[model samples]
Target: MDLIGALPRLAARRPPVLLVTMPGATRERLAVEAELTGRDWPSAPGPAAAAGLVVAGRAGGAQWLGDLWNGMPRPRAYVAVAHAGDAPHALDLLGRLLSSGREGDAPRAVSAGAPRGAPGQGGGDGPDHHPGAPGSGARETPGDEDGRSGRGGQEGRNGRGQARGQGRGQGQGRKQGRALGLGQGRGQEQGQEQEQGERGQEQERGQEQERGQERGQGQERGQGQGHGGHRGGVAGLPMAGRADDRDGLRLDRLHLPLGPALADWPAGLVLDVALQGDVLQSAEAHPWEAAPAGRYPFWGEPWLRAAGGEAVTRGAAERRRCASHLDSVGRFLAVSGWPRPAARARRLRDRLLQGAAAGELAPEVLRLTRGVARSRTLRWLTRGLGELPAGRARELGVTGPALAADGDVHARLRVWLGEIERSVHGMDDPRALTGVDGPRGRLDGPRPPSRLLLAALLPLLPGAEFACARLILASFDPDPDEFVGAGHG
Candidate 1:
């Protein structure tokens, strides 16, 4: 039985996939075939863990692609989708790649001579043990009474003990000398043991004294003392000024960057958040390089094309809108930690993308809406969260779900469900597309409404817990591609 001959059969087994999504790459959202083919999208899959790689959307920067390719495990398959609509084609290519196995483009095994483990560390055969480790044969030498084997203290003591025994043996009569030698040997051993005990005691006292001194120094340093008048930076990180926390106690500020590459987050939006405990103290958003030049934002494409006078059909536009709403709903559900409905929403979204007629889609959509809306736990979690007053929303020029929901995440979901229902009915209007209404907002404006949505959301995050803050942001589901196409960084 040749092991190499078995490789092809083993490779045919269903492969787990790691999705590396880039800006404008929403193809992974429509992966309905994943369930059918036994493909899994785990929360986090490393290169070695995933047997296949899917680069969704146009490939991103060269550095990112290179890193991903380098990290992929052997026996790996790769497929790329140039646009969100090309997911099905990419899946076909991926299937062929996987099925080919060792006969075609299977990944090469790692070189036997490849360098292993961290720098200066032994090869990856597991951890290296020190002299103090168990099974290391590190027992103290019999003569090392002072435990300072490196200082030659044990050698000197042994020499003196032998000399005392020998001198006593010479001074006494033959038989008496043998007995004296034995007695002196016993006495010398006792003396050495006593000295070793005293030495150990002294060493412990010295260590305690040193620790006391260090603690005093640490206390001085803790009193807002630092080299440049800043509280000693946390391990070289700059220390911002202190602020009053919710408990009225002043606390140091820590700035952390979340997302731009986070799980379930919109791609390319980085939030530089200042946090105290699990609470968001403040946040500033930095957008990534604008979406690739010239492509319409996927969620708003229909309205954008219509506004551009492309003579788009109303049914097509409505289909896009419903799909867009489902996309948002799926993401919201995922962030809320409810995967069942989120997956259902995504399946419906894919069905819509595959040209499912409204008559066929309406029942499931209604069922999903009813099931999600009936979740009392979800409502309790989202209630009163990120409240956007109507006047303020209008002042900020926000439209779409934000305006319709009057600004709470709970209300926003309600508005999304209502719009999805309306979209189903509007599918057969047969009218020529004229307006710029989209899932996010009107597309006739110079700037996408989502840009304003992110801005309006910043103020709502300060007092919220980090988890709630993430949910609030997910509820909005602002498209980062909008910012990129608008020339934002």
Candidate 2:
């Protein structure tokens, strides 16, 4: 065979080959290896010594060469074969490759000038019966196992090699003639196991491919059914509608959080709403569809859409209002008799500032929130609240709320939240705020009862500490429509 054309023939004693071919080429190379490469993805030995990279088309294994040398002590050579007869070019293309290895034949140790067993070839198969002989895998005869026997013998214990046929008189001669099948059978088992392992992996890969194809087919069928429904000219879903982002209307089969299932309605109707800090953040009144709006969904239709956040649509302003189970905070503020939720926040902020200056807040509170409220003064209020100057509140363990864990217990915050909520919602009047002064001159002015805007914040905070500390979130009217859009539609 032409050595260059027959690379595998040349590589029978070379390093393992790794065919880094793409999909189309992968199948091709696998078949080629069976007939040509004489290697496979698994049987390749180390990560380093894979034989040849049989790639597809062109530019196959070029990019992968550098990455191969990254952390390796001695990088293995690459043979990028996009087509046949590319082996010689691959060797030439690689500038540096490990040279053929030295130290193959073991040096014979001889006395001074005794005739050495030449350079190559073992002592003519005499001691070859030993396990480490040239033909190590080959078996020996039973007679060879006996110390008195030579490499070829018909007596004593049988090794693996067969002996010459002899007369039937001697038992050793007869035994040698009749070979035991022990060593020969073991060799066959090893080959069978390797074949079985390869077959197992191939079966696993086939199963994976089958599953993938099944999933793809299922997805296609579902898409086809949806397309057919739209083309049938439905009333709720428009045939021309794209995805929600591209089309004003979004049409897909989805559930309404609080309404009947879409499967009940031939034209799937859905509704969605989101709120933050007791105020509507955004509202979308359109369908997961857009063609021509249906004869305006009935006002009492439980799942009617609203302009939660959609752009102005034709006659959108005429749609009936949608009620959101949102803005619990705003509802509570309304319930609490706090006038004008939005306006009261400004007033509350001023009072907190006043309390800071008057030394009304506990000393630790000032330290935590105001960085010690630095000032050059020796006033009485400051002296009393900052230091223990025999004050009534100071005398009691309730030294205004504690700042540190030791000073103030978190459990107290829970109690305080309840008390504040009760006060805000009219469960208890603001007058019940024992040590606090009424609205006006004092910090935290006891405002004349009016609606307060706390993050449009509802007074019914969920967590105990939040109720106590008033951990209310704020609403930001990010878009101008938030105010003008009233989301009435």
Candidate 3:
């Protein structure tokens, strides 16, 4: 029936793709997302389900990239799009690779039982082993490390192996008990101490059963110690240390580094946090490594050029400001568990960037901003979260919408809506932009406003739940591009 040949063709029809964005590559990311949306291809939720990976932007020396690539299942394809203009071609290449059943020069798939620390698997003696780390000996499941849906076959095999070992141990115990019974029978025939001999044999059989159980348990433990050894941790990762949580209760605190690659998160930003059961105990923001010197930050380009004595019109700056807010709104909505509005927001952002006139975009923009504003459900979800009062924000050198909102997550959202509405109306303004303020904040500061935004996160995130923490970060929506080629704060 030629079924083997047909398999690739069938799988290629709509292969789920994982989209990765590098820092300073928002334009590339937007282009790739637009292409994928047009094709109606589904996005892979995690490495386990990805059939192809499309990295949008240059492949910098990020260690997580290698780890994620190695964790995906076999028969996969990969392509990197360094420029926005190259997204379509990169995707076409991905499709061809998937349909041709060729993996090209990617590393060989590591066996489920292979030790993670082995050569070329990307594992080492360092504590860099996370769930999806290359050769970390950990299974890459969807969502969390403890999840179990992705690797069912390997788990089943291990389960069956344990069962067989237990069965063999019991069988040996039975044989040993039978031999003791025969000896006891011979002793009974020799003397009148038959009762005592039978009691001794019964005790021996009980002891033998205990030994059999011990052997079975030992075998199970050995099987469980895949590559990590028995250090009392999952998947060879170190055990989480215990700490006193906010409520004065001791809990296990797991150290997790978020971002630099997470979806809807700021590119090139990494937040290292110690969490005690989803409650962040502490957080530290790692300074983003600057990109090459000549590349300008995308959203703040107009203002930056204006500051450099270039003639930039107010209308162009306003258009960029609106688009920037739309982008942030899209990310915030997506992270808030509202994907439909998020997609609409991105569509509007793309239209604005493509030079749509104010008359054409005003109605759609108003519709989206109003829809998000009037959503009581979204308001309820975000209200009273990530509170940064105006005084506190001023104290931290914060400005812009964060200072304007001066309240909580909902307040920041309101500020964005207001700014977006105002900017939309000013898209036709022809006056020269005298001010050096960009979408995020003033561009003439000693440090970028985003740096102050990043600083604010240190105080706001610790008391919030994990999901709330993400929402708070989205509310701030610090653009990593602003930090490119700039000194650390």
Candidate 4:
């Protein structure tokens, strides 16, 4: 029936894509996301599930990109869209490549090894199987330096020892026969006794080796239980260290970095965190790159241009501000585990960016915002999270909605909703722009507002759980493009 051959073609109709966004590539990312949504093609959450890799914008010398591509299952496709306008063509090419079913059309993997089975197959030890991932089984014990099993090596050593023992016994018997001139029977008896002793010693040594191997296996099992039911380290990586948690109890602290390639994550924003039992002990924010000097940050462009005496219209600035909030709202919703509202927010944002008039977007925007604002469940989930008093924010040189919210995650969300409503109504204003404040913060600050946002994270993340930490970052939603060429660290 050739069902196996036909599977690739069937799956190619709408292959899942793993989209990677590089630093300073928000415009291209948005374009790619919008295109994917239009086609009803699903987005793959990770490389393990992806049938293709779609990178929006340049690779920016990110070495991890190649690793991610190699980790995906074979018969995969890849495309890089350097410009927002190129997203459609790039994705179209990806689809064609996936459907072609020709090995030569597939993107070359970084590793020369044959393609591995899908994740969870092959004893759940495939390249994409992360030991820490939920439901992953125990990790296979690492082999010795020469790639030989410990048991096999131990047996080989034991065999050689037995051979040496026999040779020595034979030599002793012959020497006794020649030197002492003992009877042949006596010499043979002595030789047999010597050989038996040697064999007994070898048996004892083999037993000790087996016991040692058992102890090692037991220790590994204990370590796996202490961690996530998998070995602590993989690929020669070191194991996590122990540290006192918030409750004063010592626990394993894993240093994990949430990345530059995660889905719904900010472009180029990397949060290096030390986590103990799902709670963050500390977090450091590193902006990978910044917009080049004289290049405007995408979300803050209107305000920055207006501040530069470009004579931008107030209506245009308001529209940009509205779109910015929508974008942030979408990311927050997605991270909060609400996909439908997140998709809706993104659609609204795209419509605004496409120059849709206020009259056409106001109704939908109002409905989305109202729904999000009135959800008790949402409020309950976010209330008392990422709290930052107005006084504290001002002390940190923070501005914009973060300062205005003056409370928790819920407060920040409310501020965004309020500003979105206000801006949507003002999108038609004809007056020239007068304020230098951008969607994020004041453009005239000594440093970029996003830098302040990044700095604020160091303090806010330490006491929060890992999930709450992600929400806090999403609420802040610092645009990395603002740091470009700004010598950010």
Q: Rank the candidates by lDDT, best first.
A: 3, 4, 1, 2
Ten residues in sequence with the least summed lDDT for candidate 1: 150-159
Provide the TM-score for each candidate, comma-separated.
0.65, 0.16, 0.74, 0.74
TM-score winner between candidates 2 and 4: 4
Q: What are the per-residue Cα lDDT tens digits for candidate 4 across 344-454?
A: 999999999899999999999999999999999989988899899999999999999999999998899999999999999999998999897888888787788888988
Q: Rate the local accuracy (lDDT) of all candidates.
A: 0.59, 0.24, 0.67, 0.67
234-345, model 1: which lDDT tens digit per residue? Answer: 2222246677888899986655545444445676566767677668898888765444577677777777777767888898889989988988998788777787898899
Candidate 1: clashing pairs of residues = 287-489, 290-484, 291-484
Better of 2 and 3 by lDDT: 3
Q: Which stretches of candidate 2 lie over 4 Å from their true place?
A: 1-12, 35-42, 49-57, 60-65, 69-75, 84-489
Off by over 4 Å in 3: 103-232, 236-238, 485-489
lDDT of 2 at 349: 25
Model 4 clashing residue pairs (backbone): 290-483, 290-484, 291-484
* Candidate 2 Cα deviation (angstroms), residue 363: 96
**How many collisions between residues are there in candidate 3?**
0
Error of 3 at 421 (Å): 1.2
- lDDT tens per residue, model 3, 1-489: 988767876787888887767667777888888888778787765555678767665554444555456556667876665568766666776676677776533422211133422212211123333233445442222222221112111111111111111112122222432221233333434344333466658666555555555554544453344213212222222246777988899888766556555567777676667778767888788777545466778898888888778999999999999999999999899778788898899888988888999999999999999999999998998889999999999998888899999899999998999999999999999999889778888878788889889898678889878778888999999988788733223
Of the two candidates 1 and 2, the one with more favorable lDDT, higher being better, is: 1
